[model samples]
Target: MARNAGKRTSTKLVFLLSCAGLLGAALIADFLWASSSSHSHAYASIASNWVLEKSGTVVVPNKEKAEAVKSKNNSVDARILSGTFADLPGPELKWEKMAPAPVPRLDGSAVQIKNLLYVFAGYGTIDYVHSHVDIYNFSDNKWVGKLDMPKEMAHSHLGMVTDGRYVYVVSGQYGPQCRGPTSRTFVLDTETKQWQRMPPLPVPRYAPATQLWKGRLHVMGGSKEDRHEPALDHWSIAVEDGKALEKEWRTEIPIPRGGPHRACIVADDRLMVIGGQEGDFMPKPGSPIFKCSRRHEVVYSDVYMLDDEMKWKTLPPMPKPNSHIEFAWILVNNSILISGGTTEKNPITKKMILVGEVLRFDLNTMKWSVYGRMPYRIKTTLAGFWDGWLYFTSGQRDRGPENPQPRKVVGEMWRTKIHL
Candidate 1:
């Protein structure tokens, strides 16, 4: 049990402030906010993995194994999502709908410590964001409990990473959309479930790349306080047991391109960063309403790797431009798999485009491949690998395949076995 468990820093003022300003949402932002969805889907069952035949057509062992499961009841059952080329022997992917999250989340962060998956604070709406943390038991396949963050904790776009026992959450936007970023950082002890304030970031950032590497907590690129400029500064702090050993952060090699909403991972002793965007919907300088510029969104497929010499190097770009994929990655057989996110936008309309392909990046071969596709496109999803199954939950689902637009933020928990 935690030492001081029931105590909470009151966030009522800010929450109300956000709601009070809700009607002041920018035109682009108002257009982006999606209403709830009641869409239902039918899924099939998978027999075996996929194999690419000599004719270059991907085929699965069993194709006609269809299973009828109703998602209306939020049943925790398995469903199959196969390839679109029904005539051809397309790849078959298996997925399960576990219990939905306690609340809809986006722009938040999640970390897995053993079997317990901890979901942090995030936006439930442009005017509303949750300040509590939800815990999901992987073995039990349900939400077991919830914990409230410190009153000072940021509400969304949080940069988070876990060192197995202690999860570090760095700077992020503390209020509603375009309110501003924070320099405050916190760490949660999984054993005690106690969140203790850590050293504040030298500069505040929005959805920065956070990772634990070689006895140090490395914090890198995100956006600045204004939400328009990128924070290219890279800083690290020496620490042990979730406490900073040094007084302040030490300057490190900055990333070539600075941006937020990037996936940061430290695998096999090397640091890697994948798909992210540079600039995004920013509030006009003097407008009381955070008037957004939908046309300014510039999503990218940039991938960067930190070499052993403490120098930054470039890697092969992704198959297409992707962003908003934070926490949507899982490691499988030495390859990094990114599930769903936003891809390129429409050239003429400038509307945000969603992604459905499961991108697999071979760390050994330094190559990228499309493992399969998700039944629907999503962004800001959380991912975890347990019992040999790839589980991801909580994201904004796309409207539909024919008109794949960003829909409402959902609590749907979906899991699939990696066919690769």
Candidate 2:
């Protein structure tokens, strides 16, 4: 009986030790697995490895889509693009109207900092151009005044982009109203509300499309001195140590074809420029009116795409030959939302054709389609994307007889939502 008890005790001890060893190994394996999983997940989140991950999608809300998702309350939201259109009545996209700017100004540049939009330098009322800066709060829905610009620039185009703080104003035309093609660059610090002069462009170009990409700002395809003469000159400015220096100015790829002096967005490292008047807007005799034939008008629907190698590839053209002063916003993956501008003749006409057509371009698919028009017609307007919608303010209709000096501005505000 003693021998049997000893054997049983030894057998129990062996089993317990075996079980403990197994448990220890399992715990260690689990610990290693957890550590490896954490590392893999973190890397996957930041690396943008589409192959190792599923493709994400965006659905813009429209009449059809909005109704489809109405039951599922959290899935869709309806919004509107307001203001005016040549043919459309009322607001196009059911948008919330905001407070107008203190004074209406056209061709003014806007940059968003800290979720706030800042407007600066353009043609103001009284037929006199001033360097005024207006700050608008989206959350509060009001326009507040800031300090004046350091120099007065009249009849100028502001090529603007922001690093989320400092707004970089690139090569634009500015001078006296009559002789306003001076090559100038300015930088504004949104935090301090300060403006400083930066290095000027090699040549004077107005309404040039400027964009920031690959740590450099590219200024390309603008008018040299006259509106009729377009510059194929492409220049890149490097921002270093918080100043625009001349040594940093290097020429890159010239535009394949001369485009109007309007900047479009650089989406997916691809740069595009939209419409501007191809022929010169020469002053007519006996009248202050400018006349030009549309025969020489090289209306561009061809959207050019610039690659990292600085080579140009023509994407599908814009849906229409509409190019007053259009702006582009990144709607979603491989798609851009473009809106506003004029669809009139190059020199314009007694009856201005204000374009409210909002179109979307799919970069991946190379297709173009119309969305909706603004409630009102706007030309020479400054537009940028903020939050989740398209925000455009401070524009002017076609040159009216009341304001023949070309400084009439608009006070209305509009927004467009892309349901995706």
Q: Could you say which candidate leads in TM-score?
A: 1
Please, what is the TM-score per model?
0.77, 0.68
What lDDT tens digits, residue by residue, belong to model 2 across residues 1-420? 999999999999999999999999999999999899678655533322111122211122234445555656633432421112233322357666677777777566666666577777666642355577778777766776676776643345656777777777766655423244667777777767777777777877766777777778778776666655767888887775356645657988788766454546767666777555554342234433232121234445556778777788777776666554633343455677665665533121122344555667777877887766655445666565666667778766533222211224676677766575
Q: Residue 345's C-alpha lDDT in candidate 1?
A: 58
Candidate 1 collision pairs: 44-80
Off by over 4 Å in 2: 1-91, 152-155, 175-178, 245-248, 280-298, 326-334, 344-352, 398-408
lDDT of 1 at 348: 25
lDDT of 1 by residue, 221-286 (tens): 988877867778999998799888988999999898888888898888999989888776566577
What is the C-alpha local distance difference test score of each model?
Answer: 0.75, 0.59
State how far residue 225 of model 2 sits from its true place (Å).
1.0
